[model samples]
Target: MKKIGIYISGLGQSVHQESIEKYAMRIKNELSYNDTGIQYDIKSEKIFYTQDRESTVVSIFKSKNDSEQELVYKLYDFQYHEILTTKFKTKNLLVKNLILFGLIIKKLPQIFLRIFASGGFDRPYLTFYAFTLLLLISLAIIFLIPVSIETASQLNFSVTIPEDIRSILENVKSYINHFLPISCIFAKIKEWLVPVTTFILLVIPESKTLITSLATEFACVDKYIGNGEQSQLILGNLDLLIEYIAENEPDSKIHYHCYSFGTIIAMDLLFPIGNIPSTNVRNRSALLITIGTPHEFINAYYPRFYNNRSPIMEASLTWFNVYSVADALATNFRKDMNRGPAEFGIKDVLLLPENINYEITSDKKMNIFNFFSMNSIRMHKCYWDTSPNGQSCIRLLFQKMKQQDFI
Candidate 1:
């Protein structure tokens, strides 16, 4: 019997598994009809089966071999006609949709909870009442505060500066005396109105959705980079994704995946030094893909920045940088710049289309939330979206890996 394998991708849920099996069986049936003597087996986290002329092996594999065979089958099916499409064709769309559905399966429990709680009046009413109370309190505070230039200057420093700061003590007293009364009334009025304005702004549904979506995405990758108290979050998320991969494909001898902040954590695991011992697991990773990774510390501004000479870049077994035209975070400033399809003695830096533009203004510059734009929400999170060539870029990546026998 000629052996063929199928590996299912996406979340393991009852509904998703049932649908995948149905589709897999349809494909198997089609192939069986087309080729008389061919035999095939399909397996995923949830299902397994085999079909041939002589006999059928529909029992689930109890051990690791069973899971591996299913994975092989799923991968072969993915690389078949679907990945060959140049545009978003029907079959490709179907597969992409199925994969998305599978991902959704992972979130179904939370989704159902949301649906269940949506109709309840208690939470909504409580939220509204709390918002109203906060608004009223803010208004009262604003009205009571005065807003003169002297008063503003005085109030800003009141908590920090002591009366005994000899040189400026007289100047501070004079400043307050000049502007306190006039500034006080204006400040009060402004304070009363600010909360009302903020409340109105938050109530805008579209703005709220956009903010929520951006926040959700930010939270997903927040702990991975930058500074401050939550720096460990990146390590936690990387560990989570790694654990996910390991749990799903324990038999995968050579695991390869890319990440931004996650790259640092993964590198530490791959190349242990100092007191840390190596995680001596049999299943070692083969490739490391890093996109927009900051190898050296540089200035945060546009004109003033210096790249650090770090050896981290030299250590990667196989690394690829999938960057964007407008990715200011990963600007190339090497001494001998190489451009075009293949440069820097590396294969190619896949530059994706610039799909988002973010603007930073003086007034909104202080808050972290203002850094994101609506376009960022659409471009970054749209991984499942089909590329211009009609294939899901994610699926294409998997296909390319499989074709090269990387997985």
Candidate 2:
């Protein structure tokens, strides 16, 4: 029998330990295949375990043994080397070099064109143009030069958007739209230019700095929903959980199962700093399972731009996204009942009951009625139920982990 430790977060630290113990026991009973004892530990972080203790520990870090750790480090170095080599050969670098060469060739043409256009060969203007051309070439070369994949992956692309400030901007736009006469030429120009200028500013790197300042200003707004802050908090907790598992059980591997916000946090950790660590230590124990996660939300928010790839997609990791039609949060759950499986990238498995109105509330009550009733018709509520569907889903998740040789 393997000793498994399960860690759960999201629930605050004020939660009673007795409740956690009971929950752990129930989970253990549900997943029991033998005399496996699953221990549950609740902290202000997220972790999950099963009946296989040794495997769990190994999943947390690269290796328990010194030889394996050394090998992992060496493998990481090799991957970095590969990234550098590949980057040097990329089309972007070639294009940049070609552009610089083209600029050099056109130097005389530019000078002649300027001289003819301005009625003289002005040395100062020619020098300015030359300098400008050099500056452009230099910038192109610098940006086009490919760095190691490890280094590229470590780049931060996240931008924080404050709701209150956005609201203020919206209000200003609205006021401008309403009170400012659209028929007036100046007003029309302002309307067109405002959005264009905003778009251009956002494209600039300095926008991130401005956003940070704005976010600080709106920090005290009571109605503000700090999704970015929440994301960071969840990410921090995940890192802590991973570090804990790595420290406590060096030989075991870590597998993750997540739902909603939990899924987002999992992605953040797996794809930290825009790079997925290709080391065996990182990949060995990496199996991700996401439930009811809005992976498409980022795309939806941005429209026609699929910028946010799930960490599962970025890394060489095995993943399963479980979704149900009965969950309101699942994409298009209310529109087409059969669409859930397809939307979630899981076509074969249907976890929700057919034709069940997830929005409807039932009169039947129990001790845990509040928990289940909160989202009565939604698939999210199904997790709280001790039904076979939920049980099977949990069991199958672990079973898949085992099949991946994680156990």
Candidate 3:
């Protein structure tokens, strides 16, 4: 049987193709004990389509023994939304998107809930989107069809209208999307809106879904997670697994290997709207291995969002959270709270000091910001790489995957 290994990247720089390769290398070598070169063929980039701005890269892996069997590794990074926001700050595209994003985020749960209730968001749903887009656009223009004809007839072309008057009318017509030009501001907004909305949905957090399920978790409002679709793409793609579980298929198997903010996104995906209502959905994923998870930050600082959010979803599913004392990104509080796995349905928790005793050197930036400079960031970033201590987080996770029969 083949396996699906999905990686959800944490917050920060986007997970480049190399990062995916290295992470897969850890899984391949640590589990299969093979160092076959792993590479990526980017499935999507810039996510500039529909304004998704996320970058998705996938790696195909075949089992060493069974050529017919393999694992497909996917990295869904919603970093592009943030990238767009940060890179084009003058564009103010990010904040400009809040309304569009908010509306989409609000409606998504109803869409998803309807899907699961009816079976799943499969082929029909996709087809619906296409037809719906066309139908909606057509409806918007329905009233204009006759009006356009009327305007055309009223236009006194035989009267030789002044050029400036014609130009103003042309611009007005363009504003109404009559005959759009590339340079028009309305044209730009129209052009960018879909893409921005696409990007926002691609990385929109499940917190909206969470609030949908447990309305009181918010006490007042919903907190949608992620500034980008790295999470949304992952979640949308993850719908496949969720569908499998909803159907209660016998062969469905999936797992999440998430890092940093990626872990938070994974949390929203797994427990969107709080605890899963169905065992099929809860047990669909074999396990969740979180690296440098910041669950503690959410749980403590943002307790409202964390109130009903759980690291573990079911008694049967294995949830392994990998954190290190030195990694600035990982947290210890969530692990401490989930000390009793059975209580929370979590199988196990790990606090790795992968680089604990490793020596740190500070060359020191000669600048004033040196006040904030430290080597811990170095340790956090390099946890994937082998250190003198001979323990890497990736390697540790590979071992766990095997032990848990996730491989």
Candidate 4:
């Protein structure tokens, strides 16, 4: 039977033809190992359709020994990174900031829940760490102010001052004394207000790179929240692509491999049976694999978007969700009815053994600080890494795929 894999990338990671070709080659090599004993070769081609949108298909052909090459797998890379360029105009800065603050206030509960939900504290404590560092720096500056002023005053000078200069100095001293209390009060107020002011500044479009990245993430999430334009566009493309494949290859078994935010897109496309292709399609076997997904994050913050109704599962489609607690953004796609949508049809699998200590470096010992530092970020991308830790996860994933005859 012919197998087809559709790969959907997440935020900031757009796959080009060269990248997809490399990815297909990696999969081909993995399948050709002793685990499968199937030698495979790939042929990649570009598919162009409506709206000038394009997709790349890497066709994998397999053969044993000197046998004739037979088509076995087709990997299609679908990218929607153009959605990031969607502009969110803010003509009135004050109004925009006020609206953002209001939304944040309304979602404070959900935000806190996300911070303390599960996994490591890296993502949860990132803002707290930044705030703490800023507070320490401010305190250091405040501490040096009086000391520097006193040191300058203590500088003994034997030179006699002129009468006019002395009078001017006295007048300046009097003015300083008169306004010292008010200046001190203003300084204290500014110290405390710096964090809030910084937050407002970050809301501006021309803020720090971190804030811009955050804005991009939120913008993408907003598009997928409701039936937004990006949502409709991606879902439409998926539907059309699947239908086309089903028509052209009746015996093909299609699979979806979505990562990070792409999982949300795939869920939006395939969660409901009505959203899939019509019954006329001959190809019925369809599987879904979601890796490093932030499903819980979206469900926690935007409950209304995903929890409006129960998912109508497609009989021919099966979903397998892979995640690790080490990944700050990834989590077990929870089935809590109150907090998230009822995922009755999906199977959640833990990717790594949390108990086993995975050494990142020789010198850096694993502690609370190091554990929650940059390791969490690296864990998010461990799904495809060839390191020992990632190899174990990949082996487990391949085992799961073998059970479903997906390789």
Top candidate (TM-score): 4
Q: Candidate 4 has which clashing residue pairs, if any?
A: none
The 10-residue segment of model 2 with minimum total lDDT is 72-81
- Which parts of model 3 are misplaced by more than 4 Å? 14-19, 31-250, 274-280, 310-312, 334-371, 386-391
Which stretch of 10 consecutive residues in model 3 shows the poorest summed lDDT? 213-222
Tens-digit lDDT track of model 1 for 1-407: 11222222211110122233443444344434445764555554422211211111222221245334332233221111111122223333224333333333443343344334533211222222222332333333333332322344456654665555533655654665586665445556566456654554554335433333222222222222222223333233333434444454555443333323333344444443222312322233444444333222112111111122222333324444443222322312232212223223111222211111122211122123322232221222232222222222234344444454553
lDDT of 3 by residue, 295-391 (tens): 5433322334544544445544566766554444345443232222222221132222221112233333333222123223334455554322234
Error of 3 at 215 (Å): 30
Which residue segments of model 4 deviate by more than 4 Å? 13-18, 35-38, 63-67, 88-106, 113-211, 273-285, 334-374, 386-393
**Model 2 misplaced regions, further than 4 Å:** 1-23, 33-227, 277-284, 297-315, 331-377, 386-392
Q: What is candidate 1's TM-score against the reference?
A: 0.35
Assess each prediction's global lDDT (C-alpha) against the native. 0.32, 0.36, 0.43, 0.55
Prediction-by-prediction clash tally: 23, 13, 15, 0
Query: Over the full model, what C-alpha lDDT does candidate 2 score relative to the true structure?
Result: 0.36
Expressed as tens digits, the lDDT of each residue in 117-230 for candidate 2 is 532212223233333433333343333222222223334546454667545555654565487552454445545445644543444434333222222222211011223434
lDDT of 4 by residue, 290-325 (tens): 777776556555645554332343445666667665
Candidates arranged by lDDT, highest first: 4, 3, 2, 1
